[model samples]
Target: MPDAAPVLIAGCGDVGMRLAALLQVHGQRVLCLRRNVAALAPGLPGFAADLADAASLRALPRGIRRVVFLPAPLAREAVAYRTVYLAGLANLLDALDEPALQRCVLVTSSAVYGEHAGAWVDEDTPPAPLGFNGAILLAAEALLLARLGESRGVVLRLAGLYGPGRTQLLDDLRNGTARVPRDPPFYANRIQVDDAAAALAHLLALPDAASVYLGVDDTPLPLHELYAALAQQLRAPAPGIGPPPPGIGNKRLRNARLRASGWAPRWPDTRAGYAALRVDPA
Candidate 1:
């Protein structure tokens, strides 16, 4: 035995479970922690702990070497973002300060870029969050960088996640609720859920992970294009064009930095990724 604690996945949800599966295939045991232990995968030991509660974090195992912190806010509001991304992350960091810790990889949002004019962004682009959602995530990243530096921790800003069982786009198009930006053809990035999880695991083993990397697919497409594809698949009416929605990010996310790190998404584009996904009407 390595005489070390299992890898800790704080907030082990669907993506976390995916990461855990990948790691376990390589003979690694992962400690799964979340507010709802029942949600964890079978055959894995899980702890019910809320990152927002400092005391609950005390239940974290000793001798943890690596941590993947990925807690999603229960809501999209600012206060909810602050409580989960900021306070919850702070509590976890406070609880795990052991010398045995090797790295802490954080999953964040691409909203931190704040580019609403179809600009291309990457790790080097200075984060200028325009909304509270981006602001909260940026604040968390700042805190993480200040607290752990590049050697001990890194951040992964992921694009929109879509994959099996996650078909909001399909649902919207099928229900005649999908809207596309008419003028600028609102553009954004996306990554399949499996790719997001794989990116985290890739960061886990990289010898020199950068301070930050954008987790997105190679293709950045207009909202209408994505919607149209789903419409065709669902045999529904094409999505109508309208003014851009409030949070429909108008920027292109670049994944070269992550790709340069030798990680490429299996589903490199929305067309290929969404091919096998179907929205369940039940």
Candidate 2:
């Protein structure tokens, strides 16, 4: 990676913005791209483009060495997933100048692994997506590698993302609305948003990064156990017995590959991550 070349982060939202900050702190030039450039901080360079519309991405910045595809779907439907993860990703890759591009990292999800029946999953685990969201994202992952080749194409399969603004778990615990099934032992996997961003930064600088990596933390607890831990931390009542959260798979992810790459999360445990959020909700 050239020190003077800039890293372009497509779909610069909360996590993307956080990544840009981390890259900047390391003396790397950063450029952001998203639909709403006005939301970006003052003096931050960016471009306004809708990934769904290929024509809108024609004016992308040139000489981009590293790219991060991190767009979120506009809706929860299958069409939304296809449009953002598939069509949007295709559009961005087609529009970017590739001569200078060294790597293109796609921020995907662990949902692609589908339900694992409380078993452990790793990068080599075959993807068995169960729903439209996971299916489309899996397709998108294929498309990225097909377009960028194995060396340049990289995927970070992140688990559930939570941080300062994402407080539904806390609210549910406080309101006594949180519930999970205890008999089957549905598992939960998650990584703090800041840690997620840091992982992205870590992969960007890796010279021989693998084609895929699971971006989870050190622990994957059963849903009931996680909620109980959070409730204990909050001094609130335990969650009730009910169906597990909809649309997520039951699996435990291992971060050994990413850890072996010399990138360990600052908060390896979700409990400590949440505690930090409580102390400094920035």
TM-score winner among the candidates? 2
Which stretches in model 2 have alpha-carbon errors above 4 Å?
Answer: 279-282
lDDT of 2 by residue, 113-215 (tens): 8777889999999999888888888999999988888758999999999887999889989889998899899988999999999999988889877899999
Task: Please give the lDDT score at residue 163 for candidate 2.
Answer: 89
For model 1, where is the 10-residue window of minimal lDDT? 273-282
Off by over 4 Å in 1: 1-4, 278-282
lDDT of 1 at 282: 31
Best by lDDT: 2
lDDT of each structure?
0.84, 0.88
Candidate 1 Cα deviation (angstroms), residue 72: 1.7
